[model samples]
Target: MGASSSIPTDPNQRVQVIAAGYGRTGTVSTALALERLLKGPVLHGGSQLLVRDDKYCKLWLDAYKAKDAGDKKKTLKLVKEATAGFVATADVPPVDFIPELMELYPEAKVVLVRRDPEKWWKSVVALTSKATPWWLDVAMAPIPGWRYIPAFMRRFSKSFLGLAGVSDDKASPAELIERGGPFLLVAHNRRVRSVVPKRQLLEMELREGWKPLCQFLGVRVPKDPFPRANDAKAVDEHAARIFTRVLQVWVGIFSTTAVVVYTGWWLWRNKQQSLIRAWKSLKTMDVRKAFGNVWKSIRLIDLRKSFGRVWNFFKPANIKKSLGAVPKAVWPESKKPVVEHSTGYSSIWLE
Candidate 1:
């Protein structure tokens, strides 16, 4: 998705470009570039469908359902309504609906960004992760509004990959990518070529630069270079930022809850008759005295033991087990062991 400030606020804005390319094919860069050229935000699927508005996922879900039920009119209408205010649509679920989108917006120019099949598959493998990690859900659970993202990703993954005839509900995005991803990429580009008329379609690559794209769209090229975004390093940095924020929120919640529970227990243990009096007494207490009381109540030995337990939970062996570092139970006893995870963290610790 484009930055919040870049997204159009007006629901009346109509889509002028339809990106029929699969994701990790410069769709994010295309969305950013289109924002500059078209002077309005473009909808990038996957993250956009869940991150921006809470209702978008539901709308797209309904649209997918309508399409599955052979209700083309309803599907088009839902997609139209869902994408209102965007100047263009790009990436996954939207890529899957190119035919319907072309039917919905006849004037919208389609841009199919192509990548080398082998390179695209490698990128996809590197970029994708499990649909949702257990830690992510646990961290986001307290924030009711943000809790919908994981669920949306899971649903969207199944539906989007279904276009490639992948119906494995339990498979991770990485797993799905390992299974015929190169074929899917080639077939999808071929399908786009067939579905879109030559007059309406502009097939180019990320390395081709802005000239072709600008000429095709009939828009003047910007003075600045084209946007470069969603690359592997950028993606890693973005994920790191999100994880940092989640960790901060989780720590704040845990600390606040612990303090509140301790305070309540202190009040109950003291046999305080009136809640009002207890609060007044707490408020009037000396800062040093209060700190001392809280410290004494917490019991240093117990706190230290709790920290030790947490440390042990995140120990190398435990972390590995939590992340599925061990081989599968289904593997035959005769077969050599296979470790499917990345080795990036190996430099930091040994297991």
Candidate 2:
């Protein structure tokens, strides 16, 4: 199908632009561009829409039937109405659902941001160990959240379909990125060229900032430079955070279990195995934290403020809403339950 074919006849009709590049494809830059150039609100990986905006997600979930791993537009009519109504929200980068997006938003504008393949490949390769939570590390498996386990398996299938030049499954510190990169870049190129004007999808780098992107998207340039790709070595920093959070959770749970058993006294020794198992479970990402980056990356949320959302979910205080017994935030002076968790996940590492 063609670009005009999927979109409404009105040239001015609101367009849903899916920046379909996998991770490290200048998605952040693209988000900044769309916000500045199109006078559009960048959903930042659809985080705001998917998590914060209850109505948007509900309609999206209901419309698309919220398939975990398959067609994204099962509810196309619902999508068009919901998305158009809240033009403020952006679609998540459903990497696998590109075809559906193309068909669903025929008039959708697609931007394929890519860099030199060899360079991109190297960057992706470097990121193999840098983006995943360390709990997944063989050495770290003693801890749980890092593993993402089978329950979270569908998640990996959803937002991130291995972007390196390799398979997406069980990526080693090295080979994990070999299968997904080039193919993803190629797929994106084909999709955008087939739909939006090739000219519309410029090779705009984040370092160069808003001017080139703004002009292409028909918006005025911003006074400030757009955020660059890989600032502070983002992938590495992210991976570190994953590892750190995993460590915190793992240690937190084991320590909690130990103290509880000792203080309660008379705990059976055989129960130690169960406690250890529970500790491992806690070591996994604090429910909110586990999906935090995924949500941010999928929806491109500016995470500066998302910690509160994550913390709320992880460190819920409200008894009315909690499951797994409300977590008590372990602070230097006190452990206290402080928030409500509505995110449909939980972990022992949380206070």
Candidate 3:
């Protein structure tokens, strides 16, 4: 039995339902149904780590490390910490630690949610068909803030593939599933049955719906229909929606950044041109001549002030007469006779 030394044993807050099911075996629906029936928080696989608090991701990582190191006590402690506040835990990390969980909370009911293995495998393939590519993993490795996505992908790949004793990095999904599916499903079901007593174990299919689950958990049947969730189509739609929204956001960010950067560069270039023009104009300016003109204006002002009376005495009756102005031109009597050019066109061209 695994030791739970680090976890404070709480009889009152112990997990009441542990859904020991493989992924894509209607585990999501089981989780939702259990939550509604049990009327308490239920931790579903990847829900806590991916959708909920990212802090739980690190906890799972630690638990995975502990499991790999064969430290059952540490693994149990990490599982307890990860699922501390939940009343029920199902799927993934929890499913992997079922034996330890049964030892910790013997009173907790274990529900083995099963489906047709082939159909389950199909659903799994549909859901994970878009698994992050190896190139994407490497590309995202060096990115600062985007490490979580690749980290989650890596951890998820490890947990799911590792459970089936397949290396995701080495094998394609089809190959992994074909080779390991039967053994994985059989082993997991056998292990759960062997560990939990018949009285405390409930084997169920989603098609069986709420009656069995309700009876097992001792909860009144809900008036509403049993939740048939995480269908392959629904999963695909949800993934597409999320992808579209993320793409739109990234496009918007890239566009806004491009506009801002281009505007700043254009403004800087214009300012640079203006500065260059000003410098060139300044360089061409005759500084000595400009200073001379200024000095000459100042001297004229001084002269006007020193000889105000003499200047007025020498002034002519009319300034125009003193400057010898010419009279305006007068027209001759006959329009000065039109002149003809050698080129067969009048000197005075007409429209």
- Top TM-score: which candidate number? 1
Determine which window of 10 residues in candidate 3 has minimal summed lDDT: 1-10
Judging by lDDT, tell me the better candidate of 2 and 3: 3
Task: Arrange candidates, best TM-score first.
Answer: 1, 3, 2
TM-score of 3: 0.65
**For candidate 1, lDDT tens digit of each residue in 64-123?**
778878998899899888778888888766887888888878889999898888888787
- Per-candidate TM-scores read 0.68, 0.50, 0.65
Candidate number with greatest lDDT:
1
Residue-wise lDDT of candidate 3 within 48-117, one digit each (tens)? 5445345656677788778778899998898887777678887676887888888778799999987677
Model 1 residue 146 distance off true place after TM-score fit, in angstroms: 3.9
Alpha-carbon lDDT of model 3: 0.68
Kindly list the per-residue Cα lDDT of model 2 for residues 1-351, writing each as its tens digit.
000001123333455666655545665556555655555444453233312334443554454335533455464555555445222222243444455555666655555566666666566556544444443545344443323232232243332344333334443443335334555555545655665555435554555666665665566777766655443254445446555866787788789999998866656665787899899998874888877867778777657678877777776464345664544443455656445443556644434
Candidate 1, residue 286: lDDT: 96
What's the alpha carbon RMSD for model 1? 35.7
